[model samples]
Target: MGEEEVSNKQIILKDYVHGFPKESDFLLKTSSTIKLKLPYDSHDAVLVKNLYLSCDPYMLNRMREADASYPTPFTPGSPINGYGVSRVVDSSHTSFSKGDLIWGITGWEEYSLITDTSLLFKIQDADLPLSYYTGLLGMPGMTAYAGFYEVCSPKKGETVFVSAASGAVGQLVGQFAKLMGCYVVGSAGSKDKVDLLINKFGFDAAFNYKEEEDLNAALKRYFPDGIDIYFENVGGKMLDAVLLNMRLRGRIAVCGMISQYNLEEHEGVSNLFCLVIKRIRMEGFVVPDYYHLYPKFLELVLPHIRDGKLTYVEDIAQGLESGPAALVGLFSGRNVGKQVVAVAHE
Candidate 1:
């Protein structure tokens, strides 16, 4: 018997992106190969067969060459890296053994040999769909849970507003707020997504921000008494409007600024005075900063999912080939829900 060869399909970044990303900015290359075994430096490495790859807006920032912060930027000639769910085929790590289902930072290929086992979470409840790990149970789920309960300090009957309502985190936030007996409203880019917020996700009200000429007027229409909390996913103009409509001592949890990600010049927020006038508490957050809270989040959310008290909608594109389109689609509002690429099913 010889070492088995595996065809590694990858979505490679074409070049360092300057502005908005296009499908052409990536190449679906199948010229790579991998051996199905751990190397000598595999003290904590786990070889995994990737299943679902999450397409999140934060990935756009990673494509830039300027932001050289933690995790670094995605290189020009490497696979487009993101969070994914996978099954461990081989492991040299103590925490994970062979055949264990795990989810974390894996490459956009068929097989990923992960060196960073620190972030990988073992899937204890395999009864739930593995695809859920890429969206609902993974980073986005953690974002929604932490941003709403931990950050917002939500109380019963409080008015909460979410931007990008039909998105991965936004949908879950709305659901969580509803469970807390809070008045929840969300804004989406399209009427379809708006309807999903109200009809599907049980939001108190929802509106298409694209149709609203005056966002302030729209906010006033929905939150007549003003917003008690704002879960910010889309930024720029939407953020400005929410600032003006916030109640005194309102809390704001900023998880992302999808609207300003690819802009040549970022939009300046002119609502600083509104924050001062309202005495709103606005804070930006990164998901990795709160990974320690994953166990707590899972305990709170998993039961709701099993009992159907909470639901998740995913806009899945099939195969590694669909990876490029899915990644580019996040900024264009092309996906209806949480955009995911199903690399392989197992």
Candidate 2:
């Protein structure tokens, strides 16, 4: 596309979310003109052509008001921001050059002016599909690595349970746990996802959480011994049930609470008192805090991927226009794997 032909299509927030977000909550609009060149005097910034965008559960929290307790919310009528892989078209930044591929926080648009260039990391391994940066090679991958290794601190032969096991992060956590010689079990919402966990990701066992009449009983059935580490993805009832089945000095890494995200009021875990009885340790963490270790994470996961010892699955939406539906699908288990929207190709 020539400079004159460049145009920007953006997905904008329509309003603050009250309950579960719908497609109507966003408005897709196009700009009349999109400049391929960065402003001449601009310093430490790069203009990028966004290729793909990630749809993650954490983005749901940003749809609400900017409460003092949580991170800042998305501004209404503005383009929503998330992790994306992009190609630099113009640069006034020293660290990046034209045609360099990068990934980090970028707007949901065809083009974005990234002022904080430090946040973007240059893509070194183009041998892998660039879209991998949206999930397995990006934030979700880092989340699974840090949450499991740094937070949970697993040991061999330990029993680990992951909720939302077929989703991006949960799937990786389960695989990583298995590789560490742990007896790993995961719970997903559907029979198909359960099969993916066990058959594809090599989980020791998996069950459809929806079919279980009693979550505690289901946990006991899967881990007849006891859960030594729980990689929490869907909180609420699953967390409550897992609490009852934890071994002494168990570890819980609170990565996400997807079940509670869209509720009118967050559900409380009634069995949290089990933490005291079992001497369990529970902690919550964000992936960005561990960004410094990304290079190290790549060194570990990349080899596994190359050797076919690790597998990743993605559910891709075709264009920027599909971003709204893809994002809203996360809450309803509408996405089969890591949900991503392809905006443009380099």
Candidate 3:
């Protein structure tokens, strides 16, 4: 058992995609093999057996040709990599040891040889579901925390509007807003997701965006006094609608734009004048910028989780073979909540 070779199944991106991605866009190779141990001279490198993988909308951008913004696109012939929960099988780094549970950037394969340990974070509390690290306790959770408290600078009792409100980050934003005594409303693609927002996440109000013919009017009906904070997740038309409905001195934290990710030409928003007229402040944020506060964020959220003041939903697809479809489903709004691919039990 010292150094064993194992069959490694991997999900590889076939090529750069032009539009909405299909399952066929990925190539699943089951014949790959990886050693259970790191090389003798391997320094600062660790070999891990992946447990769970996150399927996020931003991965679509990474599937495109490398550009200034997406400089590190997935290599066509290599395994696709994203945030995942893994167990260390072998480690040459002092920070990690064998059998350590961690969540960070890892490959879309059964086993990953992580040479870059900069992003890796060890899981301190193994009692909490390890899969939560893929969503609620991992990158998406931090994104919501930073975007809401840090970027938006929300005040209690303020009215909040979150788009793509049932997804990973948006769902947490809604709950965080409610915990702050803010009136929170969310928009989702389906009625079931809308129900999840209102019933499950304690959103003040929720709506199915697909059923609404006019998004701007829909927002106006719900937010009579106007929105104080807008957690921007879906861009394009949704942004335009939210822009018109925003209150004076409103703050917009732009976390993601899932709606426009697959488009050849991103849809234009024609409401720039509203920002200046209303004296609104809108800023974009990346979670890494606030990674330093991870410990502090956990301190605030962990208690809520323990006390049942917060709830997180996840749509899990089983096996490494299901990875491609699960990743593609995110763009189409097929997933109910945070989409995760479960590769192994432990």
What TM-score does prediction 2 earn?
A: 0.97
Model 1 pairs whose backbones collide: none
TM-score winner between 2 and 3, please give it.
3
TM-score, one value per model: 0.98, 0.97, 0.98
Q: Name the weakest run of 10 consecutive residues (lDDT summed) in model 3.
A: 66-75
* C-alpha local distance difference test of each model: 0.90, 0.91, 0.93
By lDDT: ranked, best first: 3, 2, 1
lDDT of 3 by residue, 121-178 (tens): 9999888889999889999999999999999999999999999999999999999999
Instruction: Give the lDDT of residue 318 in candidate 3.
Output: 96
Cα lDDT of model 2 by residue, 95-131, tens digit: 9999999999999999998997656889999899999
- Candidate 3, residue 126: lDDT: 84
Q: Each candidate: RMSD to true structure?
A: 1.2, 1.3, 0.9
